[model samples]
Target: MSLLQDLFTRPRRNEQMGSSNENRSVLVVGLGRFGTAAARTLGELGEDVLAVDKDPMIIARWAGKVPVMEADLSDPLAVEQINASNFDAALVAIGDSVEASILTTGNLLDAGIPDVWAKSISHQHTRILQRIGASHVFRPETDGGKRVGHLLASRYLDYIEIEGPYSVVKVLTPPAVCGQTIAEADVHGRYGVSVIGVKNPGEEFQYGSNDIVMRHNGEIIILGSQKQIDKFIES
Candidate 1:
């Protein structure tokens, strides 16, 4: 039997296998940096991941780490042989070639995979992928650049953008809020930002509460709209 056949027919590491509806069984195409990272992260999170790539060296390198197979996903036959429809989601992370990425994505969709996510390197690629029925198209380089720009331009130690204009930020507790309890500081009322968590030096993070005292040099996780967060950091 082929690798795809063996992977589909054999019992998974978890005895429950793909039978458990709570978890997802994902088919990851391509073995580039983004694909590898996604497969590893999904496996760590208890998701069933079957990663495929055309490179034999790449397959061997990730053998023990993630369930992987050697196959050129640009070919429709490869996708069909794997029973692509059985997967809850398919991520096409072929970054090098726009043609291969598009072909792989189309093949997955042709196989009836409902959620086919693809990685795109440019706006035109993104539009093409979307027009061809890709459920989602993500530009990792663009997103990462934005995140890095935000970090570099602000006092935030870490910044994460959520839906819309909201963001979550980790910042050093400023002098204005130091020596004051969360309730006394009135962070939410004064700055329109909510202190969701706090971490002191060399200590684990604790959920924010009314009684938690803020201290200089400590770190705080705040959530608010982008404008509110920028103002809070400036204050």
Candidate 2:
């Protein structure tokens, strides 16, 4: 699968539950790392996407791969000219200039877009963006710290947050559970979690197997509430 597809792909349960929501168009301002990733994931999820950046080089890089435009997002007139009504949400991904990020976020809100997400470099910046009508503000550095903490605390190979208090976690089979089949393990009944899939060495995810005995250190993907996941890890 493509990078975007990989990023946006969800577990089967989530796919079924979320099927009712419409695929809304997204406008991502700035072609930086965060912006590009968001745009790619949005596109992979079948949403209409428009990516913008002021730099010509960045625009050239992602031109054919996705719909990209060049503009100084900080300029009110420049932002106002765009057909913002088409987009249901906007992401302010500008990393360097706080001024531009704030201005762009405000402009999007003023244009009648319902949701505006912004990236912030500091706590003060986050407060400023929130004051300017950004519906959501993220601090990448802070979130990165929390992610690393989760890895260390749970020893999970990978983790992704889902809606509410649920998470999907990938963990290697510990020595105690290595020889157990999914049925023998009784993961859901015992731990209040579901084993979504498993991955053996040199193999792709196999989601249909219940009798396959896990080998030592084989990886397993699971979906559960935070409390359930924590209990599973501790056991």
Candidate 3:
């Protein structure tokens, strides 16, 4: 879509989640892929997403999707303007430029925006963000690893652990009784699971080693929740 269309069409992140009982603004520092996606999610969810970036191109890309501006993200002064007590929640999704990202996060915290989520490029980056009072930190690439680990160890990448081992996950094929069709991996009967999708190598990506293209480094995405995933990982 055109830049104009991108601006008007892309929704921001979830504002409802960002605010308390009272409405509040959400600050999204950085307009990269993650920031853009988050901004869209919040905006579409009826939240106010105020995003910032140094590049006008980046700002223009998200023109109307969310309230965006072109400014040096690390500048505390610029951030102070957007991050008054008015911002209930905030996030930093800057990638590659570690120094600028950390500085921006520090500025956000100093501005007293209560809830903050910061993306990290490395453990050190996380440390600094933490020092600056980032409430939540995530390493997207590292998180993708946990997913890959679950998929590689089992035949499913379905559920996340809410509490403990008692997980809720879905399946595509059940566990094999005796190597039946791709659909025959009846994980349900064999392990009391649920099937969601099924695919073959040349067919489609339902959720199976046969269909999943393992990376050269031997990573795969399967289909199962944390409980069933344990079984896959053990083997």
Candidate 4:
């Protein structure tokens, strides 16, 4: 049998479910790159996922892996048919067709799905999705570019942007702070950055403590605004 045919004959995850009302169940619409990635990660995280798409080939590929359904999510009736409201959250990952993306998002909202997250390709798309009641809108390409830009411009071993202007960064202990305890160096008072965690050369990460000494080659995780973090790193 062909791969698609073989997948079609296999038992689907949805069919094996004891109950669909389990906590953390998610409804994922659209089986594009973003959608598939989200579904797979959610599955690995132990969330029950029902992934829906209109393309039979996409459905075939995902069958028995996670819950897969073939349906036109742009159509409100189709969304209702699958009982999209049964899940705790829904993700609209349609990237190519703006019209379909908007329609699917609207359909989910109309179904009373409280948390509807959508992926937007442009500013206009984001605004429309928000106006139409999408709970959250993300631009993966734009966000990924900004994240990569931060990594490339600094000595940061890792960088993660938090809410507003704040960020969490991992970097080698600065020369100025080396060989001093957090309290002795007055890291917070002098640099305006909070050392939240630290990892020695061969040890696991540990919570930052005032008494913990900072070593020259050790790594520390700092939390502060971008400017403060940059200033601390430059010191």
Candidate 5:
């Protein structure tokens, strides 16, 4: 039997392979930087991952971290070798070539992979992947754009998009705002945002206390709309 067939048909003892372990299988097609990160993260999270790449060199880099395979992902026959349905999700992370990305995405969807996520370079590419039944199309550059925005703004130390139009951001308390308690800061009242947590230098995050004074010595994590965050930063 082929490697793919062996992967699927091989029997496992239920007691030896707990139900949680059985449920965490994922297939990641393409081993570019984005793909490699996804595969490694999933493996770290205790998932059984089959990470594929067309380039042997890329596959070699992550061999021990995740189960790596070299395959021509654009070919439908090659895709069919795997029992695609066995995976809880599949990620098509081929970023460079639009054609290769689309073809691999189509093959995975056609082979009945339930959840297929494709990386897209543009809106048009996203639409094509979506039309081919990709469950999700992620623009990796969106985060890069957010990071750039933060860098330009200068007030924020870091920011992450949480959902539509909202983010979790970190910033230092300005000298103007130091010595006041969180309640006095009235972050939500004054800025239309909420302070979620605070972290001092070399310390873990803790829930913001109304009584704890801001010393301008640590970072504050806030959750709010981007507009609200910008307003807070400007103020």
Candidate 6:
């Protein structure tokens, strides 16, 4: 019923969707809500999550919940202790301070983290994070923007633009598209988009296009480069 309940209600196996390997350790560089969620999710799925932050209060809050540490995330020494190159992945969720976000990400990349999933404030920051070796970066703020854009752009019941030039978008299946296979939709040929995944809000997700109608709040994600996404949006 509540947002927390909804998040926890998502299928257990689906929670940790990306990064197939769970045996490896994951480092969450910021202990903000986003970082906390990432850390807890990793920990829940049998992966080791190392959460670090500069705030003593935040660090103390998650003390036993997961392996948490208080450290100056911007300091290279703090990053050096962890074998970034060896860690399965890392997530940076520092809010507001663009420099701290950039610097901390640089430290992790420089430390040689195998993969980094940093959080950014905007499209510009996302690009910067990538240039610095962030394997991936997420923007909760921009995600909200995409949702709004989709709702406003079309008569589609739900909408979500895949971040960046990835023309792919994850949207609630517009009734206009219900009961139709992707090929029938001609999304690529017409909409200039490709399906990435489909998740019915309260049901399982179909990765890529396939047979099956996921439930309401079900998400249909289309993929394409930025230009392609723009074309779809404008259409």
| Cα distance off (Å), candidate 6, residue 153 | 4.6
Which lDDT tens digits does candidate 2 get at residues 92-164?
A: 9999998888888988888777888999998999999989889899988787887788888877898887658
Where in model 2 is the C-alpha error above 4 Å?
1-22, 157-232
**What is the clash count for each candidate, in the order shown?**
0, 0, 31, 0, 0, 13
The regions of model 5 sitting more than 4 angstroms off are: 1-23, 55-65, 112-114, 131-135, 175-184, 201-203, 208-214
Report lDDT (Cα) of residue 102, candidate 5. 93
Worst 10 residues of 3 by lDDT: 210-219
Q: Which order, best to worst by lDDT?
A: 1, 4, 2, 5, 6, 3
The candidate maximizing TM-score is: 4
The TM-score values for the models, in the order shown, are 0.77, 0.63, 0.61, 0.83, 0.75, 0.65
lDDT computed for candidate 2: 0.80
lDDT of each: 0.87, 0.80, 0.63, 0.86, 0.79, 0.71
lDDT of 3 at 19: 38
How does model 1 score by TM-score? Answer: 0.77
lDDT of 4 by residue, 1-235 (tens): 7433433343333544676654466788889888999999998988767888999999999898877889999998998777676666789999989999999999999987778999999999999999999999999999888888999998999988877989999999999989889999899998899999988787788899999888889999999998899889888
| Worst lDDT 10-window in candidate 6 | 3-12
Error of 5 at 95 (Å): 2.2
* Candidate 1: residue 98 Cα off by (Å): 2.0
Q: Considering summed lDDT, which 10 consecutive residues are worst modelled in model 4?
A: 3-12
Q: Tell me the tens digit of each residue's lDDT in model 1 across 1-235.
A: 8545644655433444454456667899999999999999999998878999999999999998899989997898887777776777889999999999999999989987778899999999999999999998889999899999999988989988887889999999888888889999898999999999999777788899989988878999999998888777777
TM-score, cand. 3 vs. native: 0.61
Backbone clashes in model 5:
0
Between candidates 3 and 6, name the one with more favorable lDDT: 6
Off by over 4 Å in 1: 1-23, 44-46, 60-65, 109-115, 130-136, 209-211
Candidate 3, residues 2-43: lDDT per residue as tens digits? 432343333333333443454346778788898899988888
Q: Write the per-residue lDDT of candidate 5 for residues 88-200, one digit (tens) a residue.
A: 67899998899999998898888777788889999899899988889988898975886887767767888787758888888886565577778898877888888788787
